[model samples]
Target chain A: MELANIENLLEKYFEATTTVQEEQELQAYFSQDNVAPHLQEYQPMFQCFTNLKAETSTRNVPLQPRKNYLKWISVAAVFVLTTSLFINEWNKQRQAEEAFEYFKTTMALVSQSFNSGASHINYLTQFEETTNKIFKTENN
Target chain B: MKQADFLHTVLPFKDKLYRLAKRLLVSNEEAEDATQEVLMKLWSKKSKIEAYNNVEAFAMTMTKNYCLDKLKSKQAGNLKLVHSNYKDENTSLQKEVELRDSVSFVHEIMEELPEQQKIIIQLRDVEQYDFEEIAKVVDMNPTAIRVALSRARKYIRQELIKKHNYGVS
Candidate 1:
């Protein structure tokens, strides 16, 4: 193909208007051993494309078993995480409830102590008042 | 997709995935990890893989995404100072050195491209995806893909000419 025609096709290719056959033609043109000197820079780009081969591994790594094992591992991780979070929250709530119960008991003990002290002071004042009244009446 | 079938279909592309991961991550260990992760993803979503029109492209996209994720994680971890020294054994020592130079040159130039353009080159050129397939993979219009590819090509050509003193039209 003429350079101009190839250039036109390349332009069409960029425009997304080239047919598959035209694309193959472009690939063929670029794949040639001899390319235009100016376009030699694009040789690698095209060769990279033409030389593109699917990757294969020589090492025989069994995929399915490994994949299944990974799946199980991920599942176990999620399960452990969720379960641990639940347990942590539950422990926190239990600790809070215990603290509140302890606080309530301490407040009750404090109230009882204050009540007993006030009763004892009132009883002493009544005894003093009675003794003073008796002494005053006897003196009169 | 049956697990067996999925493995059978995808196992063949492991090398391609490894190469893509190696190129993108620049570390053999990281590439292997990324490949395993990509395979795990594929295996887990076997049905989705079966639905895909092009499984290889799908796997390539997955591998690229995994590598990019690893890159981002590494960056976030403030570990960008580390250097990767992965070498391929298939090539002779001299050719391996040349390949490393070429890969480094390409990597530096790729960093100058926009993310979209870089990915386009990685998929279309390195991964060898066709335009339509790449368009699907990248979720772009075909015209946009072609333009992006041409622009990327032009940039690489310019850079090569400047760095190597090679003439380009």
Candidate 2:
């Protein structure tokens, strides 16, 4: 192929306007053992493309059962976390009910003590008055 | 789709996916990770894979997205540079060294390109994607992709020539 024709094809190749056959021709032209000196810079690019194409096969990385395994793990974790949170909340509510009952009982006892103390104070005051009157009469 | 069927359909495009990832991430290990991630994503969404007009193009786009995500994460983490100099033992010494250096130079210069231009080069040169397919993959007009690719190639050539002269000096 004339240099002009090759150049034209190259332009088409870059433009992505070349037909498959023309692309194959360009690849073949570039892959030749001898490339025109002026096109040396493009040789590496062409060689890189061919090399990359050649390397494009399934690489055997020991399949670790898909990394989406982490997604499943995270889902399980969320389930566990939610269940634990619910259980904790339930326990907290139960404890609060018990504490409230205890507080109510303690308040009832405190009210009873206050009423008994008031009666005792009244009794002591009357006793003091009676003793004072008896002493006054004895002195007279 | 069954796992076997999904694997069968996508296995053929592994290299294409890898090349796209490699070009974007510029590291074999990262590219490998990105390829696996892309394949896993395709497998998970296999029901939608059939909807795609071109499976390879779809996979390439997925690979590019995965690589970009990986790159962003790496940047955020402030990780060591993801260099593209994975040397193959099968290549001859002289050619291998030259190609390695050239690839490194190209990769560095590629960083200076706009994201669209870099992606266009990756699609055209690395993944061997046609302009129309690339336009679909990138959602760009085909003519715009061509212009971006042309500019990217010119920039690479200029950078390479400058580097060559700099080394000689």
Candidate 3:
């Protein structure tokens, strides 16, 4: 009776009609120490399922857990980028201010030199007037 | 979902994903890589994971797709469907050898099966998945899944019995 039941279940198993419970029963029967000689060949097939199910990956699951870190890194990158840009603009502004200061100093130096030249022309005019007065005195 | 929560949820079934990859890719290293890749992909989609009714089924589908893609790529030259990892330390040497040979023969027979049937058998026979879960993973109706599974199971039985008889004779 047991053998008949197993044979029936085995047929349904191959036909893909066995329920999970019936399949488990078949697997249990085959896993025993003494399966009937005719059904012995089927032992390894069920055993293979058991063995394969036991096979777990020895390799570690490489989960980097870096998603939150990625968000933080992007934020830092933006912060760095904006700060560098602001610094560049500030540097350009300072450069322009320094250049204007140099220009103002240059203009002051040029004006001072022009004022000295004017004083020298005044001296020459005064000397010419003195010469004219001396000639008039001689004529008198 | 939070990453930690997602990890908690996925860690339990990580081995199942690995097994599916192993069944498809047939190499430990490749299977491991595929599992990791699939996990990362799921992590990327964790926000949208809530949209799915069953994350496990979704993950299984992703694993199946990823492994199939890997097999199709040129780098999978060594990824032949060979299951050589069977071992039995308690049995005598001769019996162990016989067991290993028969097991590997089963794998070779599986190799001859179409990729769909192979997956169906893997999910149904090995993983003990129900028709509905198998359908969700394969995107096939339950009836078609059952037919393909029946065909695959019968083919393996025929080939295995033939080999067993030849060995006995």
Best candidate (score: TM-score): 3
lDDT of 2 by residue, B9-72 (tens): 8777787778777667767777787888777777767789889888887887777777777778
> Best-fitting candidate, measured by lDDT?
3
Candidate 3 chain A has its poorest 10 consecutive residues by lDDT at A59-68
lDDT of 3 by residue, B70-125 (tens): 77773567644544554555898788677558776777777688889988988887
Cα-based lDDT at residue A12, candidate 2: 73
The TM-score ranking, best first, is: 3, 2, 1
* Backbone N/Cα/C clashes per model: 1, 1, 0
The collision pairs in model 2 are A56-B15
After superposition, candidate 1 runs with Cα above 4 Å error: A7-27, A48-61, A64-140, B1-3, B47-54, B81-112, B126-128, B164-169
The DockQ assigned to candidate 2 is 0.20
Q: What does the interface RMSD come to for each candidate?
A: 4.4, 3.6, 1.3
lDDT of 1 by residue, B12-45 (tens): 7788888777656656667677788888777767
The Cα RMSD of model 3 versus the native structure comes to 5.4
TM-score of each: 0.57, 0.64, 0.75
Root-mean-square deviation of Cα positions for candidate 2 versus the true structure, in angstroms:
6.9
Residue B58's lDDT within candidate 1 is 84
